[model samples]
Each structure stands twice: as structure tokens, then as C-alpha cells.
Target: MRIRIRTKWNNQEREVSLEDTVSVLAFNSWRIGMQSLLEIENENFQTDTQMQRIAVLEEMMAFLVHLLDRIAYSSLNDSDREALVSAFAVKLADHVHDNARDFAKGDHRNNFINKLNIRLVDYSETTWANIAQEPGFSMGLTFGNHIADALGPRDKKWVLDYIQQVLMPEMVKLFKQVLARLGLINNEN
Candidate 1:
């Protein structure tokens, strides 16, 4: 069987197809894996824990994508769409932080790096590249500035510091709330 996914990119609706044998869990796992790897390398974030979190977040992200795809294929209201997006962002953040303590010590593999590169190329061919690179490509300038900032400190200390201190905690909190609401995590009395 085939399923259609509708995503709005560049103010247009795009459709993606999924196979029947793919479980929601498997689809999500693959998408999240690809996404997390891309973010880590593109952003130049380090820390084994952060990388691991990225991998896990990839799965969660995939799950959200699956859900969104289903909704888009069907008839979903505006409120529903908004809520799903919000929930997805939150869950994504949490999945990124679930194993922080351990992540700090581990590093990503070469396989992950290669896969991420391929995925990025594929993604760039899609509308996302247009969305990300906008306002006269001002975003590219911002990214360059970030790289420059990292180059300033000895051993790129500033960059590493930001990943650990700023990005990680924020991501964790967002995902935690999302997971709670989705009933992926229990809120016991």
C-alpha cells in the first residue's frame, strides 16, 4: 500500500510517499536519524551526548512527520495542524536530551556522517533549502558568522560551550513537554 504526506514548504503543498510495510516507528526512526545527523554536522555541534541525542531526536522527529503526513493526507483543521507542529517541536527537543549524560562521552560514526551528507543533498533539492536560505540569503551569512565565532577561540571552545550550555538544555525541556503531552512519557501522580 502507499500513503501520501503533505508538507508545506515554500508556501506550497508537497506530497511524499511511504510504503505499506513500513511501521510508524520504523519510518520515524529513519527520518530522525537522518535529520539529527544533518543538524549536528551542519551546525558543527559536538559532544557524544549531543550526537546521541540527535540520533534519538531523529526517531521522534520521524514519528511526528509520520503523524503529520497522515493528517495532511486526510482532512485536518487549522487548529489541528498548529497543535501538531507545536507538539512536534517539543518532542524533538526532549528526544535530543534523553541521554545527555552518556552522549557527552560518545562520538558519531563515519556511517552517520556519510548518510547525513546524502540526506542533506536530497533535502536541498526539495523546498526546505528555499525556506532556510531566505531574505537575500541572510541566513547563510548568519551561519558563516557562527563558524567565524567558533574559529576565534582556541580549540573552538566557544562553539563547544554554546552546544553544551545553551542548545542542549533548551532542546531537552522542549522535548520533555512534548513527550508528556503525547503520552510518550508518563506523568505519574
Candidate 2:
């Protein structure tokens, strides 16, 4: 079987077998449909991962709030407060440190450096003051030391202040950057 194809330029006629003609259309349609499906699946996977990350962040936030309330209203002693702050700091620091790569996102020009720079400063200022003098702090050890210093030997108010002022806000920003990098959220900057 065959069909004719006419060119508008010269009305030149050509013979095309029916199978060949239909094959191109059919293959293209199937390819396009598959591409669309793959795109949707990819989008859904990203959404699911982002949603899970958000849920974990919210849970951590809730834990902080609850801890703050306990510190505020309870009759826990100074040591207890310090311990609470230390525990939370270690956890928070670990979480942030683990996901740092996702937010740091290499040296790309579009990297989240603006927001990430502040967090890095906070991490540095909060953790290591004279790293040169020490010259021995690994990333994990530095985080541990920094978290300890950041929350050390303080009263309940200090604990509350550190969490409310420093920790939570940084976590929020870091996660926001992560989501933005993932294109899960729109970034104005």
C-alpha cells in the first residue's frame, strides 16, 4: 500500500508506503507519551521527597517548641536546661550537617550561597572561634564542640534564647534553601 505526498513549493509528488508513513507518527506519539509519563513520575518523586523533608522539619520544630515550653514552665534545674539544649543542638547540628551538601550545592553561580553563607557564619561563629589554634577539629568534632559551646553552662532563658533566636531560624532557612534548590519551592532571591 502507498500514498502520495505533495510538496507546496513545486507540487512535486512522492510515493510513501502506508506502513512507513504511519510508523513515524506512531513511534513519535509513543515516544512523546512515554517522555510525558517519565516527566510526571520524576515530578511526583521529587514532590514526595520534598514533602517528607518538610514533615521531618516540622517535627523537629515542634520538638523545639515543646522543649522550650518545658524549660519555661517546668522546675527543671540549670544543668537540666543545659543538657536539654546540648541534646537538641547535637541533633539539629547533625541534621543540618548531613544535609549540607544538598544546600551547599557545589560552587555553581546559582548556589544558595547568600542564605548558606549566613548559616556557615553562624556555624563557624557558633562552633569554632580560633580553629587555627586548635587545628585539630574534624567536621563532626567541630560540630560537636560548637554545639556544646553554643549551648553551654547557660540558664533556661539562655537556652530559650539560643533555640528561638539562633537554631530554629537557621534550620528553617537551611531547609528553605534545600527546598528551593530542589525546585520544590519558589525562591525570590
Candidate 3:
């Protein structure tokens, strides 16, 4: 028998099927994968095992909230930034739609997806607004100043270069590894 899992985002309903004997962690991992795509762009973000778990949850929540806001304001003019956000939302929505079973319960499942949907809906608007208003929203200029202050003169340039190049790619790689371990990658079909 198959079980159905339903989630709603931006007032749209998405459903997925499960084998009727899947584990909860498996489902959460898929949900985490759908969430991770929003933050790091690529799945190679680096971190340790524990850090990876936390990052997955954090990034997923952040992305969900962000996407909810973008969907809500879909009528607004599209800036380059908005375009990027829309792309991410489309990708995540697709993933969720494709992998409904990974998040659905095997037995008389209840509450998990419903609770997550509620939380995402309730917090997305405020979270998006706060992130947009953040002082460090800009990349090169704002982050450059932050880098200089954080790294001192002797290593400022090198540190900034590392952050843009090495660190970001490493992080993406690590994220992918975590997703693999969590069984999100192989199940995508």
C-alpha cells in the first residue's frame, strides 16, 4: 500500500507517495534536501557531521520562509535578486512535489507535514522582511568591509578570496555528502 504526504506552500498544495513502510528520518532528510537547495545553491557546502545536520535544518527552514514570501509577492516587479529567489522556489517546489513519500508516514501518520507547513507559513513573511532589511544584504561592498574588519590587514585579501572561492565550494560539497548520507540523493526519480 502507498501512503500520501501533503504539504502546502504559498497556498499551493503538493502531495507525494511513500512505500507505506518508510522511516520518519528518511522523510525528514528529503524535506531537508528540499530546504538545503535554497541556501547554498550547490549541495557541496562543507561541515562536520553534527554541523551538517544543523545546517540542513537551518537552511531548509530559511529557504522555506524565503520562498513563501516570494510566492506571496509574486505580482511585484522582478529584480535580479527576485529572479534568483524565484528560481530557488521553483526548484524546491519541484523537489517537494517529486518526493512526497520521503516525508509521509508509513503508519497512521499525522502532524509532521502539517506542522511544518504551518510554521513555514506563519514565519516566512516576517523572516523574509528581516533578512531583506539586514545591513549586510549586499555582497561585494558590504561583505568586503566586514572581511577587512574581521581578518585584519595582513590577511584580509586572502581571507576574502578564500571565502568566495575555497570555503563556499567546500561547503557545497559537504552539503551533498550529508544529503547522500541522509538518503535524499539516490531517491530522486
True-structure Cα RMSD, model 1? 15.9
Off by over 4 Å in 2: 1-59, 62-75, 100-103, 106-189
Better of 1 and 3 by lDDT: 1
Task: Give all candidate RMSDs, comma-separated.
Answer: 15.9, 25.8, 14.5
Those runs of model 3 whose alpha carbons end farther than 4 Å from true positions after fitting are 1-62, 70-113, 121-127, 130-189
What is candidate 1's lDDT per residue for 1-189, written digit by digit as tens? 112222223433344222211232233433444443455456665424444445434433433343333333234466755555444433434434344335554333333334334433433333212221111223223222333342343435555444344433333334333333333344322
| Model 3 residue 108 CA deviation in Å | 11
Which stretches of model 1 miss by more than 4 angstroms? 1-78, 104-136, 143-189
Q: Rate the local accuracy (lDDT) of all candidates.
A: 0.37, 0.34, 0.36
Give, for candidate 3, the lowest lDDT window spanning 10 residues: 16-25
TM-scores for candidates 1 onward, in order: 0.29, 0.24, 0.25
Per-residue CA lDDT of candidate 2, range 1-189, in tens? 011222122233655433333333223222332333233234332223433342233234323323232322233466754554344334443343345446444432222223233334434433221322111124223333333332323332333444344444444344333323333235533
Model 1 lDDT vs. the true structure?
A: 0.37
Q: Positional deviation of 158 in candidate 2, in angstroms?
A: 35
